[model samples]
Target: MNSARRFLLSFAACVALALGMAAPAAAQPFPLTFDAGWNGAGSPPLPASGFWDVQANWNNNFQAGTSNNVSPYAYYQETAVIGGDLVNSVGDLIATFAPVTVNVRTFQDTLGTSASSPAANRRAVAGVLVQNGSTLNIQSTGRLSVLVTYGTNGATTGLPTPGTGSVAVESGGMITIQTSGQLNVVDNIDINNGSMTVFPGALVTAQSINSGAAGTIALSGNASLTSTGSTTLNGTTTISGPNVVFNSGQVFMGDSTVFNPVITGGTHSIMNVNGPVTMNGTLRPQITGVTPTLASSWVLWDSTSTNGQFDFSDDSLTDLPDPGHRYNVATTTVGSVHGTRGLLIVENFLTAEVDRATGAVWLRNTANTGGVNITGYQISSASGSIDAAGFTSSLDDDNFDGG
Candidate 1:
């Protein structure tokens, strides 16, 4: 090759590198760092709020991956930094009203590894802030993974104090899933002061939903939530879902937990658990888009086993449509067809009747009973009077038990 041609090719390559728009290298786990600052000022200043996938929003034009491991997947393994600006280092991603897919697998900060005085610099800990009415959509293929953390720098003598990484959504911010969006969080979703809403036509299967102090998680409109690990409801977690399935773990509901499920006709919200449930919470059922009727009942939650019950200290049943009717939390053992055994909110004012000829007994309600599934109820009685000796009892049997 001639010297002139070689020089020209080398200059072109340098120009592309200087522009920071070089072609992508071979597929691998690479660092994609955010270039903007808290106030939208950095090497490549982005708007105060914008889409996350825009190439200019990242440093060195390092964009999020567009494909996943298998065919027809939206996201895959990606490691990205959230805060990297030297002057104003707090990374902010405000996605207002628009639907956004954070295709970056991990949002981390690497200042701990780069700076000399790691503790003195603010970049020691990397964090991302998603606020100002923003909505982030995380779509995954349900591949459970581990938590992504930051690295620590090595100073002259000993190792520097290790830094941390976090993702927070505050100020009415939401992490939601809609339409074909399915979120599978391999790590913890620490919404200590944020919200995560799984809308209708969407599903979210996570390892766990945790709150350091307080947070909110709402599910509504035929939405579903499947948790493989334990979930602690420490704050006001409102669930108006047709189904909330716990695959194989427990659920802890404390005093601060509140269940505000909306009933639309006979289709009310329910939590189906395959494991035990420990609750010391409150349930506030709301009737919506449907009128009050007789023989109506709503199953609050059902599980294979349960510990404590809701502390219904505050007259929560008064909010129902029928003010004159009575309500009670009835425990029912159900078959695998309907659901595992659980509790139900039914009309309390019931009349116990027995047919002496056949020993058939059933509950008759005169007031507005509301539409409730009566299949879970069973009736058994003693052969003789309460005061009689050698009294016998009938075998325990319910329709669901196939007896």
Candidate 2:
């Protein structure tokens, strides 16, 4: 539904539940078909179009021009299939409460006029082509599963026609998940200049994320995001949480100006890509739980093969504590340690501290646990290199273990 009409419908659903409004005792709910006034409104003056939750818009046996709204109950928790197109003719947008599934058979926004239509004429849509500042909120009590194009009419009815429809959140559109809200998309999410925010305590699992040039995804607080397939992010992914996991497949990172992965204690953000990773842009890593000692290393990107490298010069690695050494990143084979090749940040320290008073030189064990040998190690200064045989004579009468 469009504008205040659509917002009022969502509000009314909440009020109806509070008022204990129930369907008729004889009414048996069934899968609703999106006829959308295709066959003139059964009731006059109400128009053929209506909201998804409204009783007048749905048809029980939808067959294009002959279907009628035989079902008297509004679809609250029933699985619905949008067969025909729903234009924002007069604010006929859709917003429901805790719907189990909303299958998009064809293009829901076939007309594609709502984006250019007036505010009063635009629909607050939840299906495909959710654009033009439309906001779809998944309540805490709701679990909305959007099954994108599969067959001719989604996964339910395998129509003869091949599925060519796709969903895109573009042009200021948003899908916000409230606390404890869950949204699972069977197909990839193409965020074309739009955004999806998962608030704290909320969860969103998608097949993959195809971020457009202007698209963005903000995972705030303790929200969890799991993308199963390959994710090629060309926009920004702002994550304030610690539970974002890219479990499998290749991940191509590109133009991520706001990507920051944090490391807290023994647990940190991980992108376990089973294939190659094409790296680009800046990856700002933060350490919160533990202090890094000399020769400490952390693996940020784990993959079988890496194509490119991140712009480390634009990172905040210098903010970390430097114990007479600097932190640098390198693409190395971590198979013996992590079973894959990855990009790791290591603290390289190899200088010795000399006690001039007693003429003692101390080389701390920064990398290994056992003793270190400096038998043939070169020690040079501004004047010249010290002779190995006569270097000990130049020092005070202090004991040298040589290890």
Candidate 3:
């Protein structure tokens, strides 16, 4: 080859080699990098791991791509918000990331005392949509409350479908779901060792709720919860403490169930059952036992031979002008109430019938075995005395003597 020809050929060969060498280097994966102290610059997109957290103060909102990650290592010094849900063109809005822990620091715990960290309510997350499989771990003793809200639009609209995700409140953490909105979790939940509190008039629903070994649902301290659905609490439920109350309207069918409610310490609680309760285990309380006071209400009790001591009367019995009646009991079954303690009132009149054979008394004329058996005895107090025949005669039994 001549000089010019050789030069061109040599240059082409060098260019090909350089291009080949750069190909692999350009394809190498790089770690995600973003500015933490600033916001409004558009949330940096994350990989399949949709991990994100807010600790101190983030005024702006964060937007995620496929899977992302955000960890706020300090207390929320300012208000921080998550931008929007991640939905690709093909159609998938999954925000599954490795567990995220927003460490909440306490100045008192650090310098005040010798302890560096004290469990308090400093590390809490309020208002946002936490992608499914994302965990908000309350790492420090500082408390952590996660506020999850579903928008009118986007993947977080909470459509009840399969493949839906959840925001797990793991151990060393205490999360409170404040939204009355429903969270559609296609999978199960894990709240074994953590503390979770959902304030009054709040409704929480899950695909399945399974707590600690034996399915324990402890109503700790003065905290109270009102939950609905089929729950299996295998642990002891203490329903006492002046402030501890759990008004659970749970109804379980007749397979086999367990409840662990307590009223010990100084806490107080009320186990209210709106529907049927079937407990295969025991109905235990924290104190000595449940107390039934005279009230203008119906105490409906339905149990097999396994049911313990209970007192139920008609609602009219406690229908005075003042003082509403209340029933008290302690039990280990955490899903339903142990008993209903009051008179069942219906319409204007209070009707009750006592059963002899079954010992199951009922009101509204549904307990007498064969018609209203008066026992052929009359109570004649003054003029209202029990004659030789079983008849009610007196102002006490006289709604209408002629009839």
Question: What value of lDDT does candidate 2 attain over all alpha carbons?
Answer: 0.49
Q: Write candidate 3's Cα lDDT for 38-71 as tens digits.
A: 1222323532222233322222223332123233
lDDT of 3 at 365: 29
286, model 2: CA deviation in Å?
3.3
- TM of each candidate vs. truth: 0.51, 0.51, 0.32
| lDDT values for all models | 0.46, 0.49, 0.31
Clashes of each: 8, 4, 80
- Name the regions of candidate 3 deviating beyond 4 angstroms: 1-52, 55-189, 192-208, 245-260, 264-268, 282-284, 288-403
Per-residue error for 73 in candidate 2, Å, reads 15
Better of 1 and 2 by lDDT: 2
Task: Output the lDDT of residue 300, model 1.
Answer: 63
Cα deviation in Å at residue 311, candidate 1? Answer: 1.6
Off by over 4 Å in 1: 1-49, 59-134, 137-172, 211-214, 241-248, 289-295, 313-328, 336-340, 347-403
Top candidate by lDDT: 2
Q: Residue 22 of candidate 3: its Cα lDDT?
A: 34
Predicted structure 1, TM vs. truth:
0.51
Model 2 TM-score is 0.51
